[model samples]
Target: MVIATGTLLLALPVASETGQPVKIVDALFTATSATCVTGLITVDTPTTYSLFGEIVIMALIQTGGLGFMTLSTLVALLLGKRITLKERLVMQEALNQLTVEGVVRLSRYVLFFTFLTEGLGALLLGLRFSRDMPPGQAFYFGVFHAVSAFCNAGFSLFSANLMDYRGDLLVNLVITALIILGGLGFSVVADVYTKRSWQRLSLHSKIVIRTTMWLIIIGTLMFLALEYTNSKSLAPLPLGEKVLASYFQAVTPRTAGFNTLNIGDLRPVTLLLIIILMFIGASPGSTGGGIKTSTFTTIAVAVWSIIQGKCDIEIFGRRLPRGTVLKALAVASVSLLLVVTVTGIMLVTEQEEMEIILFEVVSAFGTVGLSAGLTPQLTVAGKLLITATMYSGRVGPLTLAFAIAQRLGRQGIKHYPEEGVIIG
Candidate 1:
């Protein structure tokens, strides 16, 4: 529903002041990108899309980031209607809640939390934007950017993204804050608000919080060390500016695409770092995509357990469930396979370099939006591949494939025993 509505909006004359009709494929592509919160674009957004078009894109990003089911629940609440049990089940799935019983309350919390964070983020960003833009325009820019940042959607009205204000402390802080809040997973935020103590938080919340903090800190340091003296981009910057730039770049790739540095100018090592970050992505139940941080953490723990010759994975004094570890492995393996296959196809169809194709594939799968300056140059086939990748990344490949492939069948009586395999 979100995709269709967004596509229609993109096609409508009201969305663009240019008076030129956008091609259907382009419209569909843009809509899918916006609705999936992936920032790949065939056309330059700021130049091709007028203010009206920008607003439509922003709306689509908002709805997509929040999930369509959450938006529907909000509307139902606004109309003073009761949410049915069936609707609650759907909401549970949409929000990735533990159970369907308290979906009504969960929906309310989601809406409330979203508005609160976005509102605060806008106020901070608006104060900074007022220095350059007129009050009204600044306010609009602030609101749009705040929502985009919080959603980790990576769509920006400014043609240069955050590059123009790369060293601006206020801009850096505000945008990073929004991105962190959005990528931290709503459930973690909710738990922090309700529990008011770290020790009282659930296991999921603990893992997410710990993993996110570690990633941000380690990522920031690694980026600073790797790029500080690189002549292409970071070398000329002052100490403080370099640190700030590194921090921003570090945070941006955890599924947010805003860049303070020229992506194409980065060292190969920095690009590799970005690929790892994008692959891990934001926490589960967050607006961002990729395999997710929890999955990464689980995989890491599982690997450690194997190295220690342990039969079971454990973390933070708790035994990890077998099913959880299996799921994480499955998700990571599938994500990697998808990226490799898509990258290979792109390489054959497009004449771009391996680096560019790999970057595009990772960007699509991660929904990270960072590019090797090749997004606008993609051929029709490349664009379609990216669109499919973005959709699969957002909906999840396994779920979407299963939904299409599912069939009713009787259980087989025969059972096969597990067999030992050759070790490496």
Candidate 2:
């Protein structure tokens, strides 16, 4: 519904650069990108969109970021409407929570913290943006970027996308912090809000925070090491700029989508690393999308347990349910299948290089908008393929699988014995 409305609004003449009706396809693509919080674009946002159109896109980004149900719940709360049991269940599904308990309060926290975070980020960025543009324009730029970064939407009014400010430590750090906070997931945010002690944090929250920190550190180090001598990438930059750009590179690929350097100029190995990061994108119930950090860790821990000859996986001193292990495997399998199928289709329809094809596929499936500058040149079929991939990424492959799968009758009378089927 959000995408559809955005499409309609964007197709109007008021949204276009020349006061002409925009192409439906382009408008639909942009709307999907914004609503999916995917940054893929066929048209440059700042140049093609009027102020009203820009506002519409920002609204879509926020709506998509908070989620439709969350917004609805917030509205109902504001209006003093009693939330029913059914509404609570829907909120659970929307937020990917394990239970309905405290959902209303969580929803409240989600909205409150979201606005508060974005407001503070905007103020910090506005101070920086004011150095370049007029006060009003600077403030608008700050607000747009704050929402975009916090939402992990990656939409930027600048055609160059922070490349001009690549060396600005303040801008780099602020955006990085917003992206990390947004991608860490609301559950973690609320956990920190209600409980300040790491030991008191839930296992899930602890895992998320720890994993996020490790990823950032590892990614930053890997990027710096790999691109240290790449003339088109890091070699030309000053020491400070290179470090900052590398840090930004690490944070952005965790599904934030902003870029301080030329994505196309990165080393092939660096691109492969980004693909891995994109596939493991943001934590559960976060504005960002991917298979999720929890899913990835669950799979990893399960494998390590098997290698250790343990019958069950353990984390943070608690046994992880067997069902969770199965679910993690299911999510990983489905995600791989989706990426493979979409990449195959794109390979057939597009003439881009393998790196471009792979990068775009992972980017779409992860809802990470960073591209190798291939999005604008996509054929109609390629665009449609990517559009579907973005929607799937945001909804999650496992969730989409459940939506399409049919329940089957169980074989009650028959019994089968477990047997070893394969060896590595």
Spell out the clash pairs found in candidate 1: none
Top candidate by lDDT: 2
Tens-digit lDDT track for model 1 on 1-424?
7777777777777666587867666777788888888777777787777788888888888988999899999999999999988888778778877567777787788889899999998898888899998989998899999988988988887888889999999999999988988998888888899999978998899999999888889999999999888998889999999999999998999888999899999888888899999989998788888888888999999999999999989998899877677777877888899999999999999998887789888988888888888888888888889989999888884363233222213346896998999999
Runs in model 1 deviating more than 4 A are: 397-414
Clashes of each: 0, 0
Report the C-alpha lDDT of model 2 over 1-424, residue by residue, as the tens digit: 8889999999999998789887898898899999999888888999999998999999999998999999999899989999999999889878878778999999999999999999999999999999998989999999999999999989999999999999998999999999999999998899997899988999999889888898889999999999999999999989988899999999998897999998998889999999999999999889998888888888999999999999979999999976677777888898999999999888899998978998998998898899998999999998889988998888866475344322222336877897887888
Error of 1 at 44 (Å): 1.9
Give the total clashing residue pairs for model 1. 0
Worst 10 residues of 1 by lDDT: 401-410
- Enumerate residue pairs that collide in model 2: none
